[model samples]
Target: MADILTVNGGSPLVGDLEVRGAKNLVSKAMVAALLAEGPCRLRNVPEISDVKIVSGLLELHGVKIDSTDRDGELLLDPTNVEQAHVADIDAHAGSSRVPVLLCGPLLHRLGEAFIPDLGGCRIGERPINYHLDVLRQFGADVQKRPEGLRLTAPDGLKGTRIQLPYPSVGATEQVLLTAVRAQGVTELRNAAVEPEILDLIAVLQKMGAIISVETDRVIKIEGVDRLGGYDHRAIPDRIEAGSWACAALATRGDVYVRGAQQLAMMPFLNVFRKIGGDFDVDDEGIRFWHAGGTLNSLVLETDVHPGFMTDWQQPLVVALTQTTGLSIVHETVYENRLGFTEALGEMGAVVQLYRECLGGSPCRFGRANFRHSAVISGPTPLRGAEITVPDLRGGFSYLIAALAAEGQSKVHGIELIYRGYERFSEKLDALGADYQVG
Candidate 1:
């Protein structure tokens, strides 16, 4: 039998919830431990499936990891690290994009790496050409195979200059991980400087890696010969915080997200205020709610960093369904991110997808046939409908829609949500949401 979530709607979700470390950073940080010469301690780690996936992958390579779920602490030791069988990697990785990240650290440690066919949320075409190209620039040989890809550093990986077509977070991470312990200094142009990326840099620096960020998407890494372990408490998950903030607006409730930092969330907060959603920022957290009076709509665009994030677009789109006017969201990050709107449409949201960029400057995908833009018309009454969870962020958006709808919603494939969200059902329960799982 398939697992499902049944949500009874029309009630506001109001309560206090704590957000742990960022899903984006924590997994990469776990991968970073492989580069350490000794054990690394990571704190505030969220209990998400991605963490489990990375932990499993690390163990397969002979890294010893100990964790305490209650305290969210992880101790990863790389002293006995060794290569595992290719079949084992394929089995453990299973549809996760993390194996691609294992490439750099594995090459540095074992002088070789193997990556299986990668899979992630089918939200867009996330080609790893950028990653592979960066590895090749670092003097790693790439070979394609029936299973996936194999990489070897015959010349003992040397650093080189690289320029990314776009500031992709994953690709930038690839460069950082590979270049940190290389033979020479490396310069990366057009690199992503997201908060999560900065946090990962902090982790690397704590491990004795020398890295610097210059203006206009430039990052420099001075290769180090020997590195030690790091102790770090990851940055709070701003994406989770923003998702709950949108949930509050959609359900006309109030939610206080503990551990939510104001700096990382400033862009989202400014947009939330523009939409007539109210928020107060304090040291501990941020409190978000739907302000009385009709909600307003505005044009928004998703950009690399210091702009509205692509992950933030979905939940806010659910809130836009309750706004008084039309809202245009131009998603420049991932091409197919707007596809989740089809379910929103089924739930009575009038959202239309557009192939051309809508209300913002044309992006890289503008010439392509991808439907990367969305027009949402609001104040429409949502009715519960059976929905399938697509990806992590999209799944949570579906939950928000269900909570704001007039009746019950049956959500299947919700296990996909566990890859990022930590104890989501428990959080929903704490918020007084009517939901059941089986």
Candidate 2:
């Protein structure tokens, strides 16, 4: 049975909250540890469901993971890792993308890898075709089986130049993992340049991998003979930081998001400023609050890294309900992302989803009746209602919607929130949010 969250609305959340490591980075970093010869120590890890999934997967491969650190530090000993049992690996195939990332490192170490199916946000079809194609480019023989994907690098990995049709984050990580141990130089074009990717590269460099980033979205990696383990700290989660910032805005409260860098979120920070949100930034973290003034509507489009993130759109839309005008949001990432707006509409939000490409390019969700564009008519007062979370970011948006609403709200399927946010309930309580687990 799914866990439910009951939130009593009409209370302003105000306090300082700390954010741990990036969920996106930590998962990939855990998989990256498989490439190291010695044990690697990771600090500032978030105690989330996805991290546990990756840890379990690593233990199945004979890697020793000691996660008893009270401070969220993890010691991963991959030196003794053996061929992982396919059946055990297949169990969590649909959990997250971290499993697919294991294919590369495992293939390099053992010359054969069996990867279960991959799963993540249901925004669109997250195909591993790009990942497979990149693996094949590196001279790995790939075959599809009913159980999972089987990959073999009999002659060992040989690097080659490959270009991605789209800058997919998972595919980019797959290439980085596979190419670092390849025989020669690997050139990857259209690579994702997100901060998480950069952090992964920093970790890889510290582990003796030679990698360089070039203009025109190119990443070149000269495969090293062997990689030594290195201790590293994961980057702060920008999505989690942004979620709390939106929460503060939605509740008309004050919150200091500690441990997150402001420069990493320039696009969101710019929009927050345009929306009349006040903030103060220091070396430690950022503080967010709604200034006593009319909130303005600004145009937003979700794109790949450096673009307005698609993940941040949903919660920001919830905050936009209080803004006194028509706010236009064009989602360029996933077509079906607007589905969350339906639940918002049920909570008294004046949001309209449209199928006609309001922005121009044909989106994956546009072919069906799924709308990619949203027009939020606001200064509409929202009333709380029962809602089910559709995905990770959508769940947090529901929390923001509940906080902004007038009556009590029951948010079902809240367990999905652990995929991203860490210490969410305790942090919410610290902010004076009246929420209880059910």
Best by TM-score: 1
TM of each candidate vs. truth = 0.99, 0.97
- State the weakest 10-residue window (summed lDDT) of model 1: 356-365
Question: What clash count goes with each model?
Answer: 0, 0
TM-score of 1: 0.99
Best by lDDT: 1
Candidate 1 residue pairs that clash? none
Residues 317-396 of candidate 1: C-alpha lDDT, one tens digit per residue: 99999999899999998989999999999999999899998956648889899999999998899999999999989999
Clashes of 1: 0
